[model samples]
Target: MDVWKLNLRHLRSVAMTVRLGNLKAVAKKINLSQPAVTQSIIKIEEWFGAQFFVRHPSGMHPTEFANVLSPRIEMALNLIGSNRVTSTQARAFLSLSKTGSYVAASRDIGISQPSLHRNVADLQSVLNFKLVEPRGRGIALTPKGISVARKFLLARLQLEAGFSEIYALLGKETGHISIGAMPLSRASLLPSVLVAFQKRHPHITISVVEGGHGELIEPVRDGHLDIIIGAIREHPIGKDLIQIPLFTDQPVVIGRKDHPLTKVFEKNACCQNSQIMKLAHYPWYMPGKGAPINVVWRELFNRVPVDIPNIPIMGGSVMMIRQLLLETDGLTLLSPDQVAVELEADWLVQICTVPEWMQRDIGITYRTNWHPTRAQSYLLELLNHHSRK
Candidate 1:
């Protein structure tokens, strides 16, 4: 199932084969020829951009991706019950789910209630499942029907983007790109690049979402995000991701303008081991688990191979650290670029010298198999240019 070949049939076929564990059994159950089932499985592989099944002499087995996604997707598809659905039916089903009543849906769609009900009934017939239940003056989707609606809605969004991209490629207009912004990129690089990009491609809609690594990473894996950009880890990022290194942001210990350390550094202007060891005396602000800044903090300890004395505050809240440091003598390790505003205003001063090894690799990560369209490629190049500068 390449771009054009992807359809409900192929999706259902692969799902059934995974559940039944053999091509022959799946074909018999679905009443399709074995050769047809084989082609459907292949189509599913192409659509998913990965092989989801392993064929052996004994039987067929689901791959790891299949094992993970199969249950969730299967639950959704089971509501439809079969693969026979038209675009009109899909649209009506989707819209009906939203409006929740044939009268309201018909009014919104600018059609008669009878016509809307007929269309929904047609969809129900094609799916071989009852999708809605009337209660009071409105209706609600069944549990399985809600699952089906969710899957189709996701598919519709993908199709909308796909068609928009196709239109752009064919010299028509309209497109949308979803980009995930990580902590570092959100501060400067991503915003600067997006401004430049919007100037060039004004009609292409761009949506930017922000979160930490744990929150952002899985959305890209599930095809909900086009790309994620930020200060990245050098160690193994998951197998599903392809990270492109853009820049290196060094981590420096920073404190308030009038802190004791700033006064001491101003007089001495040196980062001797003795001065570094004195960091234990002052209050410390530690990075949270799994943050890129945490990695840089860990690198500091790994190189020095010693434990610091005081760690009263340990979390990843930027505002809290900024205020606490401004009011007290607490210290924190962070990428200089993240606080460029504070640095430029002289509100925050660097205390310890950042070592050469204490840098986070800033970059973009996308799904490994994703091939960008013209709009996406243009943004990627813009990011590349900004990161280099």
Candidate 2:
């Protein structure tokens, strides 16, 4: 189903009918005439090609389809937080927010510019709030408008999930899982899990976006991505996100196989503070400040009485880090699992392991209100299973 094409009022009426079990009560609650409510229900049923309610002398009895769809509809309505918002308004505003100009939005959605402007203006008037403001030649959504747009996007996702669930119950697997993958997961975790999941459920499409936490978190929160997998921050991530810890990973300081530190570490099996202090003399390749590994690297130097080494290069790309380590006399902190192949191939060597307390909690992060469909839930289970091993 094209969720953007759905009439918001009709969808709400269907959800209300499922809750109230009678057309009259649904009409009273939504401020529509009983006949209007009945027509709304009929239109939705016809569009969906399924009967949601079975009429009886007593009241309307919801069908299995209604049982599967109503909760999702209600959840979507709550996320949108307004009944006055028409589907056209939503479609227009979403396009404008994404494209950042009326002309672009109109071109993107195949709507006339004047009509798109009127629809957004009408929506703003109905909601009693300014949704967009002039930004140079383009436009930008106000903070409230951005919030509303995110809710609308998530609501659309909810409706899509409902149809996907219905299709699944009818023996057709149809849905997509979009994942935000951090560097560590891309290297050591996600490949195996994705392979196994695709082998089992080939009909369900999966896409992964690789990025660092800072780049991925906002998209996941705004429903652009389903979940993010990698190291969990030690600080609080706020109430809107839920973190599920998969495993603890101990990081080690690594350098090229023939680097000076490798010879020093080999001579002294036990790493003394002086031996650790020698790291301060070498240039470091590290992630940006405040990343988990960066924090550990700083603390490692703090334990000794040496100034933290200067990070000449700062990034989260393992490929870049590996190449830099081989080409320069530099060192980096990373999980051994992340560079297992390089270590085995004698390209890199672990100079020393960080303290147990510096071990990282690797996991998954998703929106707090996210409810996974059966297939998504199965994928999470597979991630947990593989991470454990």
Candidate 3:
């Protein structure tokens, strides 16, 4: 079912009923009739063509689908809330979450306790869910409440980016882009692009979060990151993400400058002779499972019928691998373009060439439906230009 067809009230009803354990408690907390709350949860189940919660003698137990959908639903509700919830109600909710106490929340927001309570009450009425719960003498959020609070806080940050974009458009010094940098992007492409981007748009703020191929996708998909720059996969990425090709990068085996493998290659001066070298002779640094590099590594090596060693190290941190390869005798497989800076600096040497078929497509991956503001789009344009250069 289309998510936009679902409203804030319906989501809150299901989330709260699940969190609080029963319809009667959820109805009382949200100031809704028990039947209305029951109907809300049923309507959500109908949308999915399956039940989210299993009704029992005592309470509703969340199904596996409900567990999986918890975060996504909260995110959807948060997006809807930006339009449906007032600034005061949102602030009250956010402040309560931050302080974890009614008195502290009121003080932080410059509102009386009763006013804060009323704001929260009104918000709950509109949302049809319980946000706060009795914790000792003060308050705490239910599971559903905690999820909603975190999403709303993050949504507020995403919203503020629009103001920066507006200022940047008007020629004022302002903008922010949270970038999730995958392993390949962290090396040559992103570093060069960031420098050029800063030179062109000095006022823009940029935050780079480094992660593996799989690790970087979710934040960009969820709107926590402005964009993710990395190696594009050959297989289908989810429909939610859009891939824009930048360039192709071939994998290469790298070692220390004075490594025995490089020494033999330079001495023989023959690629055909070098291609027969036994891969198991050396200690290896392997990428972790589910990383794109790991798949490429298995594909390249398995065809040759070599016993892949029990990896001495399995990880995705390029910086650590770079240092390990430089100091110790450990070797790693990576895109040559990723370590161009190191190679040029004479710290590492390429020992073997990657198969042409194994070359990875480097590109930009972002949420398919994301509509970038002028400044955000300007940053993307800069990235597109970087790929060309």
User: What's the lDDT for all of these models?
Assistant: 0.73, 0.88, 0.73
Q: What is the lDDT for 226 in model 2?
A: 94
Which residue pairs collide, candidate 1? 1-43
Model 3 lDDT tens row, 160-267: 543344344345757578999887887777888888888877877889998877777767765668678887877888998888888877777888889877756653
| RMSD to the hidden true structure, all candidates | 10.6, 2.0, 13.8
Best by TM-score: 2
* Arranged by lDDT, best first: 2, 3, 1
Order by TM-score, highest first: 2, 3, 1
TM-score of each: 0.63, 0.94, 0.68
lDDT of 2 by residue, 246-323 (tens): 999888788888998776676324445787788889999999986888887788778886899998889999999999
* Top lDDT hit: 2
